[model samples]
Each structure stands twice: as C-alpha cells, then as structure tokens.
Target: MTQPASTRRLAVITGASSGIGEAFARAYAKQGVDLCLVARRLDRLEALALELAQQHGIEAFAVQADLSKPDATDRIVTALAEQARSCDILINNAGYSLPQTFLATKAQQQTDFVAVLVTSVVSLTHALLPGMVQRGYGRIINVASMVAFSSGAAGHTLYPAAKSFVVKMTQSLAAEVADKGVLVTAICPGQTESDFAKANGTDQLVAKSNLYKQTAEDVVAIAMSANEAGREVVVPGWPNKLAVAFMKILPDSWTAALIRPQAKKFALPDPTA
Candidate 1:
C-alpha cells in the first residue's frame, strides 16, 4: 500500500473489532493513515492493529471498549490523552441491531440498541469534536443505515430509529462546523453484506443477502471519499439513493405498509410489537 499523504495524520475508528469497522480501518490504513481503533474485542483489535501497522507501515493503537456503554467515550478520550493524542479524522462506526419486532424484543437488548447506536455516537462525537473545531480541520464520519429513510422495515425499527438520529445529527453538526473546516458526515448504506446478520440475529437471511448486498470495503470507500468532498450525507449505491428518494415520494401509509413485511422477514420476536 502507498503511504498516505501525511505520516502524522491519524484517524480514530469505532466498532473496529470486525465487519464494517474493520473494513474502514483497512481503507484508512491504505491511505497511509495511522489509526486509533476502538471496539469491545481486544484480541480482534490487536490483530487488526498488527495487520495495519505491518501492511501499511502506519501506526495503530488499539483501545478495547464496549461503545454501547456510557464510559466508552471517556475511555477513548483517556486513550488519546494518554498517548498525547488527537485524531485528524473520527469515524463513529460502532452500532448494534436487534432483529425482532418491537413487541417481541428484549428490554435490555432494546436498551443496548439505544446505547450503541444513539448514545454512543452522540457522546463520542461530542467528546471528540472540540479539538477538531479548535484545530479548524478534521473529519467526522457517522455510519447510518438506508432504512433510516421513512422506509423503515417491520422488525428493524430501533436500528433505523437510531440511524435516523445519526443522520440528522450529522447534518446538523455539519452545518454548525463546516465553516471551521471540520466535516461531519452521515453515511447511509443499504443491505450491505455484513456479519451484522449473525451479531444482530438476522442470520436467517444470510443466504439471501447477495440480492442487494454491498461489500464493506466498497461502502467505506464511498463514505470516506464523500467526507473529503464535504458531503454531509451520502447514501452509497444508486439503488440506495433511489430507495431514499422513494421513501420521500411514497405516501407514509403506503411506505409503512410496504416496510412492514420486510421488517417481519428480519425481525426478532418483540413482545410489545
């Protein structure tokens, strides 16, 4: 891999254990960017850090933390502070999914959804943005889902709900900080092939994923490029863009109805739903 533009430049990525987060780590490393990797799995993180440093010859610092927990952001801040650190780019890629209907979902699991998706993303961004703002140049990327569009599926409500918050929050934050040269971006990807199925309990659809699946690396490429281009929100893939547009054009009732069955297909049994 060619060295990135500046050896001094470093990026922080959440959810770096595997899947989408790992893809982002590899992509950033390819650009010669040093990395601060955060995730729950220490072993997985260490492996990735080693691979990145060895393959791309960039520094890699692994910090293991469950991003869904309240202390996750604090942990990241401490890691950076301890290393005399600050990131040139921040990627809020940590998230969780529950594959059941709202009514059938577990209460604690539901809370986990909010913790990882909404709370973690917000707290991490809040904690990390000050330095970026002061420095007058930085990149902040938030990973969202195309389901965030009004086209939410039946059983996957909380996931989209959290991603919706991410999308709106990124847009608003982008508006606030863009003038300072700090870019805030929300990337919404649709039906990308990922380990999300197994982790989130959607493994049932694994065989059918290829119908609309996207490789994790491909999604990361578009997202990172869009951030550099100052795009606040980027829905990768033409199909994803069309889906977003359809969500806007279709009537709420009709859209909701259409989304219901799809949600059911991937849903975890929710008691309250």
Candidate 2:
C-alpha cells in the first residue's frame, strides 16, 4: 500500500531509467524518499523501480512517457494526482543531442530535440512548482552541461543554447523561491560515463579520447549536496570546474575558435556521403 503524500517525501525524476537519473533515484531511495521514475523505457524503469523499492523499502513506481510529446508533462502530473502524491523534489534531467549540422537533420528532428531538452523542462517545472511553492518546500535540479558556458560549437548546435537556458532559468527561479524554502539548482557536468555518447552514436569517438570523465554516481552525489546547500549552479568535478572557469575567462571569439574544430569531428557524416 502507498503511504499518504504528507507522510513521506516523493521525488519525481525524469529520465530515471539509467545514467545520472538512475543514480539520483538510487541516492534518494537510500535516503528513504519515495520515487516516481519517469522514462521512455518501460522495461528498464520497471525493473529499476522494483529493485529500489525492494532494497530500500520505499514506494517506487515507473511512468513511461516520451518527453518529446507536448502532453507528456500533463500525463505525469495526472499520474501523480491519481496516486495522491505531490512532488517534493523534481529532477529535470531528460536530454539528448543531435550530432548533425542544422541543415543535415530534418526540421522535425530539431523540434523534437527542443521539445525534450527545453520545452519539457519548462512545462514539467511549471506544473510541479506550484505545489512545491504552496507547500513551502521543494528541490528542483535541472541538469545542464559544461557546454552551457561555451559561446558556440559546430555540431550539437542547440545543446549549449538549451543548457544555457536551463542555467539562467534555474538562477531566476532560485531567486524567486529563495524565501519560500524551494531550492532550484542547475548541475553542469562535463563528459560523464553514461549512455549519452552511445545514444548519440559518438561512443567510439568519445572512448578514443583521453579526456577526464566523471561517473554518473559522482555527478549525482555532487548535485544532491549542492542542492541541499542552496547552490544555484554547480560544475561537478575539478576538471569540469577548471574548464568552465576558462570558458568564462577567455574571450568569446577565442573560445569559439578553439572549440569549433574539435566539435566538428563529432558531427554526423554528410547524407550524400
């Protein structure tokens, strides 16, 4: 049987089937927080929910929805209402990058990317934040990336723009809810050990690189700690922190000149090829 929402804290984690989202689910479950795991992969989500619930003795359930759909947020909200649960913590972590140039990909694909990376975030947050604010307690963690600070890159053109939006949105929301006991944070992680590369078909390229990579667990741990401490933005690891620092210190033109060539390697091959 499920417990009343007032008695136990419930956290809604998007993209909770794997990677950083899964890490967050496990971390919060260990702390006795009931979980509503959101992901498009029903099998993985169900398996994870069952494992966590059994291991931690917490109420855990999976909600399968593709965030690219505009109605996805509404469905999640409705599910929570059906369960008589209100979100105490929300993790807006669902995202992916298109590895092609703007002209190389279909316009529909671009819109879908925006839907998942930007619109879903804003919609979900908007829906759940009211309940959180009214209860005078909430935690919102928006997973931006270290690229959020970059001026522009050749491939994954929209990724940085979307992440930048998340960072700015987090800051503004944090300011507004500072006195309301709701904590909003944007966690900016660099290259992480996750399926992100594989999902975008860059696994080989990423694996060949010698760049420092943080594990999903490490990223989640830092993000949780930072949110609890009322931090508005955090870069998880020292290497990522240093990188972000340089991006901020260097002139935009200089950074763009340095980043473009490197980023081009990850762009998708020409369709005509």
Candidate 3:
C-alpha cells in the first residue's frame, strides 16, 4: 500500500552545507520533499535552506551540528522530534579523508573519520529506520565513492575500507527492508567537481582530470534514480563503471603490482613543502 507523497515525505540530508550534499538537498527540494539539512556550518545551511524554500516552495530546516561528534545522531533525532517530523529519506553524505598515509596520520584523526564515516551513519539510520519501517516507505542513500570497489592507493586506506562497508551494508539492508517497502542504496561516484578537491588540496589534480570528472548535479540525479528503483549500489559514470568492472576481473596480485608504481601519483604533497 503506497502512501500519499504529502503524508510523510520529509528527508534528512547530512553534510548539506556544500558539495554533493547540497546537490542532493536541491534535487530533493526540486521534487517537493521537505528537508532537514544537517551540517557544521550553520550559516551555509541556513542560507541554503532559505534558498531552497523560496526557490522550490518546499520546507527546509537547517540543523547545525558536526557529524563527527559522538552525540550528533541524538541531536538530530531530538530536533526532528521537536518538529513533529519523522524521516522518510536519509542521505548519509558527510565524510572527509585524511591527507596523510595511514601510518603518518594522527590516531585521533583516524578515529574521527570512523565516527563520521561509519558510526554516525549507523546510528542515524538506526534512529530513523523504525518510523520508516512502520510507515512502510523509505529511502536511504549512503554516499560512498568509486574507490569502494577497489583497494586503496596512497594515503587512502581507511576511506576505501569505510566506503566498502557502506556498500556491503546497503546490500544487506536492502535485502532486509525490501519486503517492507524501503530501499537502501550506496551511491559510488568517481572524481567529482566539488569542494572535496579544495579541502583535500587536490584542486590542481582535479582540474587536470576535468575530462573524467562528474558534476555534483549529475551524480545526484543517478543516485535519486537508483534509490527509486531500489538499486543496491550505483557507480555514476561510464568510465568509473568500466574501471571498476575491469578491476573486478583482474587478479589481486597483478592489481597490487600495477597500483604500487602508480600510487605516488595520488599521494598528497607535504603541507610544509
């Protein structure tokens, strides 16, 4: 039994201040879904919220909180309760990569990545899943990366591992919730034109790879379509899909040998250099 779109179609989007997150917010707003936008930058979130509301005539509420914090999920749940809203869609899109190699990066930084990339997502999904299950309609889009399908290169050990977890979890959860009318999908986008490049100090690399890069809007469109169709995982671009497919058939030993020589190309430069 499908419910009316106006009944309980509010969406909760984390990392909604910029980049792919903001793109998802705008996409959902364009579909007339009310939004609860979460991000650390209160000003940006507020401004985006206002803009979306005016431009799309959809309700947009900004919740300012760092997803890296341990209590972030609780805070979000509390805010939603206060508003008498329950989440119909959850876009767990908040994450950032540490620049240094696994050994060189601070232990605390690694822990914080786990908190934001893995724990926060699990917690928020747990908090929101019950209402969605009861209502018998929901959508969850976990923003992973194309790297999720392949082994790490350079200083990106935890990123691929965490994203791999998201992809696997989405698969399992899709199986569990399929009969309940809820869809879970992992959106794996390749190099994208977003603030990610600026934050990681890879703007030059990104600019050089413009021919292979995807726009945030294009990625969001693919993700939304995947979610609607209950796709377990989606790799956005044709090149990325081809690359991942090739990697899948390649032997691990050969893949590792090939990647080792090319690893330095993706390595981050020393901040002090």
Candidate 4:
C-alpha cells in the first residue's frame, strides 16, 4: 500500500538521471518515498520524475544543478525548501573519473572533479544532516568504490583518494550518529554495468574484460539493506567482497605494484602522443 503523502519520506538523490542514482530513485519510489532528483540533465530528470511520480503515486520533482559548481548545493537546498520538503534520505552518488594523470589534466579540471566527488558530498550532507538530526531519523548512503580499499594507481589519480575519503567519512559520521537514529553507510561496489565506464572512456575495454560486474539495481539493493541495518560499510558482490578483503590483507606496496600497470590501460591517451 502507498503511504499517505503526509507520512511519505522524501529522498534527495544526486546524479539521478542515470546509472546507480536512477536505480536508487526507482527503488525508493516503489516504497512510496517522494523524490528530489538532482542532475545536470534537466530534461532527463524531468522525464524520470514524471514517470516515477505517475507510476508510483508519489511526489517527485527534478532539480537541475551541476554539482561541480560551488553554488549547486545551495540551489538544491533552496529548491527543497520551496517545495516545503526536508530530506529524510540523502544519496551522495554524483561522481566521475577523469582517467588522466594528475599533471596532464588542467588544475581547473582537477578542482571541479574534487568539487563533485568530495566537496558536494560534504556540503550536501552538512546542509541536510541537521534537520535529520533534529527529527531523529535519516539515512545517508555514500556511493564509494572497491578502489577505496585499493592503493592509488597512476591514472584516474584522484579517484581512489576521493573514494577513500568517502569511506572514512561515512564510517566517522555513522559512528557519530549511531545513537541519534541516523544511519550512514558507504557502499563500495566493484565494476558495475553503468555509464560510469563510458563516461571515463573505458566502456569498450570493460566490455571485453572477463571481470565480474554487478548490476546497478543489485548495488542499490545491497546499499539500501546495509543502510537500514546500520552497517558502516558494504561491498555488494562476493567477488567484490573478496577483492576488498585481499586489498586489506596484502601489503600496500604489493597491491600498488599489482594495480598500477593494469590501471594504465584505462588512462587517457598521452597528450604528447
């Protein structure tokens, strides 16, 4: 049965136009949760919001904002206020990898990447967490990656670093709010079938690989379960779980050596070449 509008929870999902973000939005809508879908693609977000609201009998709206911009989170919060809604759930899922070496990319590009991957997560959570604390109910899920546990590779230089920050931040925040009724979790998924690879220009290479890839739906399901159970961190599939375990058990230097060469394949082409 659909929950009454007054009692239905509102979830704010970043990057909701596609991939894992879309998956989370669909899952929450099925449970009768209203949605604020955030992304740069206004048209896609509007279509998704309309479709989900109609199909699920819930309120859903699109908030177009580029998280790389400093003002984006403020705009999102303002939009929610305009709708008279407070976030009961926040999914910090907006992220991308540059696939270029640190020095090869312009400083502005690196900063923008960090803004989306790190700054936005902290900013959005900071803005909405107080209300959740006051209400004594909230769920926050930070979508990290299996690489969070792995050592840094040559390319996609900041990807692992940012994700590691997310994992640690989730753990710390979850500990702080554990007794206050707010659940925080970091879902570190392995290679999943999504536009993530395509955005990073690795889709074809990934497709040709034999490595296991989880569906975005499965990743989100695991994330939702973990958050509800108050788990601090979770890796979706067993293969991913095993990989994380190995990274933890192995020496850092060993893991770094193993990962660097393989990761170079996905790196952007040399600028001077």
Candidate 5:
C-alpha cells in the first residue's frame, strides 16, 4: 500500500544491494522516506525495493547499473529524471578495492576506478545540487576511507587518494551549501566488515578483530546522524577517531610505518609501484 505522503524526505542510495549501502536503505526506510536504490545487481535491488516498500510503506525504486562505468552518473540522472524523482538525499557508497598498487592497476581499470570514486560523485552532485539549492534541503554522504591521512600507504595508494578527494570535496561542498540547508557528509570509517576486501582478495584486512572493525550498521548510523545534524565528516568509532588524531600528531613517515604491513597484505602487485 502506498503510504500517505508526509513531510518525510526521499533518498537515493548507490551500492544499495548489500553491505553499507544496503544498511542505509533499511535505515532510511525505517524513517518512512522514499527510496531509489541503485546497484549493478538487479535481483538483489528488486528484493530490497520490495522489502522497503512492504516493511516501511515507503516508495522504493530500484536501478541496476555499474556505477564504476564512465556513463554511470549520467545514467543515474537520466533514470531519476525518467521517473520524475528528485531525491532529497544522496548516499555515494559504491566503491571496491583495486587489490594492487597504483602502478599495478591497468590504466583502463584505474580510469574506471577514478570515474567511480571521483567523477561519479561530482556528476551526481552537479545534477542534483541545483534542485537541492532551490529547495534548501538535501543530504549528500560521500564514503571515504581511513587511509586518507597517510603519505605512502604502500599498496592501496590510489584508493586512498581517491577517498581523500571525496572527503575534501564533500567537506568543501558542505561549507558552500550550509546556509542553503543542503547538508553534505563524508563518512570515513576504517577496517570495515564488508565484501570490498574480499572482492580484491584482501579480505584478511578485517581478520584483525583485535583492532577496530566497525560494522556497516554502525558506520551508517553515524553518517545518518551527521547528515541530520549537518556534521560535514564522520569517522564512526572512538578508536578510529583516535587513530585519525594520532595520524595528525605523528610524522608522515611514522604514519607510513604504522600502516605498512596491513598495506602490504592488501597490496596489488604493481611492479611499477
């Protein structure tokens, strides 16, 4: 049944089939917000769409596409426009690891990664910002990583660099759109329990439970609150917050040293790197 429309907002979550993105969809639906969930997996997205609509009585639109492609951002905009849907929130959570160093990743693959990590965010914002500005209402959450503070992260260089761009860009956008009631947040959490590592053959990264390992639920909860409260960037846990603080206090070389082995464990074989 279509629930009576209220003042509740609508959100579009990329990578919504599983992991953090899926959690965000569930969380948002709990609030009775309309959803347009996008991901490469059609069956999974449709299942989620049905679940959200049935469980929360909110509209759930599903879009299946590979956001890592160059045309992905345009496709998202076009799809939404076709449905006459203008989302009040955008959660950019579709990212995976390279499993290699910058030099190891093929040029084409690197280019695609760059498109997903940087260009997609930019394009989506460009497409949606005008409406958000006009309405003075919007929330944009760009997901980033814990490695953004390091100099030589050893193996995962390009991924961190890309994430750093997201964090900085989102922070800047938040300041610019503050007065207009458009909120932007960069959710930067480290050592997450997600398939991102497994896809890259770096699943061992999460094996270290002795260290801080945050759940997708926890990370998204922090981000949702930060979005509501207008906090620009949110690193979910106490330990991760401390880690970022320590990185700030330590020398770049020391930070590199601290991150070396883990970086090595996940290093993609980039001979050039």
Candidate 6:
C-alpha cells in the first residue's frame, strides 16, 4: 500500500468492513481521500484497506473495534492521535438491528444496541468535533434508516426510535456547525442490498416485502453527495422519500391500524424454534 499524500484529507469510517460503510470507503478512495476504516472484523477491515489502497493509490488504515463497547470511542481517539490523524470527514455507520420484540430480546442485547446506535455516535462525534472546529472544515454522515419517520414494525421496537434520535441529533448539530464550514447529515435510506437483513436475522421478513431495494453503492452516493451539499437529511430513493412524506400526513392510530396485520409477517422468528 502506498503512503497517502500529506495534503489529502482523511475520512474515518465505522462499520467499514461491509455494506454502506464499505461503499463509503470505495467512494472516498476514488475521490483520492485517505481513509481510516473501523469495524470489529480485523481481517475484513485489513483486506478492505489493502484493496482500497492498491486500487485508489491512497492510504487506508484499518482499526478494529466494536462500537458497542464502552471504550470504542477511546480506541478510535487513541489510534488517530498516534497516527497524527485528524478527520476531515466522519461517517458514523456502525450499527445492527434486533428483529425480536423488546420483551423477547435479551436485556444485554438491548443495552448493546443502545451503546452502538446512540451512545457511541454521540461520544465519537463529540470526540471528533473539536478537531473539526479547530480546522474550520468537516463533514459527518450518520447512517440512519427510513424507519426513523415511521413505526410500522411490531418487533425491533427500539430501532426506529433510536434512528429518530440520530435524525434529530444530526439536524440540530448541522445547525450549530453549518456556519463553521462543517456539515452534519443523516442518511436515511430504505431497504438496501446490504448485510442488514442477514445481520439481524430478518432475511425472510425482508424478502417478503414488496418495497423497492437499492444497492449500497447507490445509497452511499446519495448520502455522500447530500453531506457535501449540506443537506440535513438525505433519503436516498424516491420510494423511501414518498413513504416518509406519506407517513407524515397519517395519524398514528391510522398507521398503527394499517401495520397491525403486517406485523405478523414482520415478526421476529422464535429463537427457540
């Protein structure tokens, strides 16, 4: 792997071993940006880094850490400090969904979900923001989901709620940092052909949906462009955008009634089965 040019900007991406994070890595590398790739899978991260480095002729470093752990942010901070790296862009894309209903899920799994989806995002952003502010330039993309705007599913109760927090937080942070040459955006993509379903053991449920699906590359393209253009929230596909818009006009009771029947189809598989 070639050394990155000192003058090139650096992007730190989480959940970068696969899916949308991997897409972001490819996009950024193509643009000649150096990358710091983080994920729990060290082998995958290293392979991705090597491929991006060789293919794009840019530097790519792999940092393996599980975002759900309390010390995850600290590990990232230390890695950056040791490498004398300061992020020009940060993509908080590490996450997983739980298909089981809140009550059915283990207590520890629920807490870990919160740690990965909420606490880590907040801490990592806070850790990186001071440096961005000092540099007077930064970009952030929080990979939220289309579920943020609607609560249709019965299981995975916290998924939509947690994503809503990300959307709102991104909007609020964008307002504060926009004037300072920093852009913060929430990328709310609908069902995309990523490891999302497989990771959460929802492949069967996802396969039953008639909704349109997108490629991770396509979704990340929309996200990265939206971040660059300073959009607070970027919903990738037209179907997703329209769904969210439609949901906005419907009352909670109406939507809930509509979703009740569908909930059976979307229900998490019994673990014991």
TM-score of each: 0.93, 0.97, 0.93, 0.96, 0.92, 0.95
Expressed as tens digits, the lDDT of each residue in 156-227 for candidate 6 is 778889999999999999999999999999999988988888888778888989878999999999998888
lDDT of 1 by residue, 1-273 (tens): 954344477889998888889999999999898899998889999999998999998889899898767788899999988777787899999876777676676688788789988898888888888888898889999999887886567676677788899999998999999999899889999877667888876687666544477889999999989999999999999988987898889997888887776656666566663
Q: What is the C-alpha lDDT of each candidate?
A: 0.85, 0.92, 0.86, 0.93, 0.82, 0.90
> Which order, best to worst by TM-score?
2, 4, 6, 3, 1, 5
Cα-based lDDT at residue 144, candidate 4: 95
Give the lowest summed-lDDT range of ten residues in model 2. Answer: 264-273
* Candidate 5 overall lDDT versus native: 0.82
Inter-residue clash pairs, candidate 5: 99-268, 100-268
Ranking by lDDT: 4, 2, 6, 3, 1, 5
lDDT of 5 at 34: 86
Error of 6 at 122 (Å): 0.2
Candidate 4 residue spans exceeding 4 A from truth: 1-5
- Per-residue lDDT tens digits for candidate 3, residues 124-144, read 999999999999999999999
Deviation of model 1 at 72, angstroms = 1.0
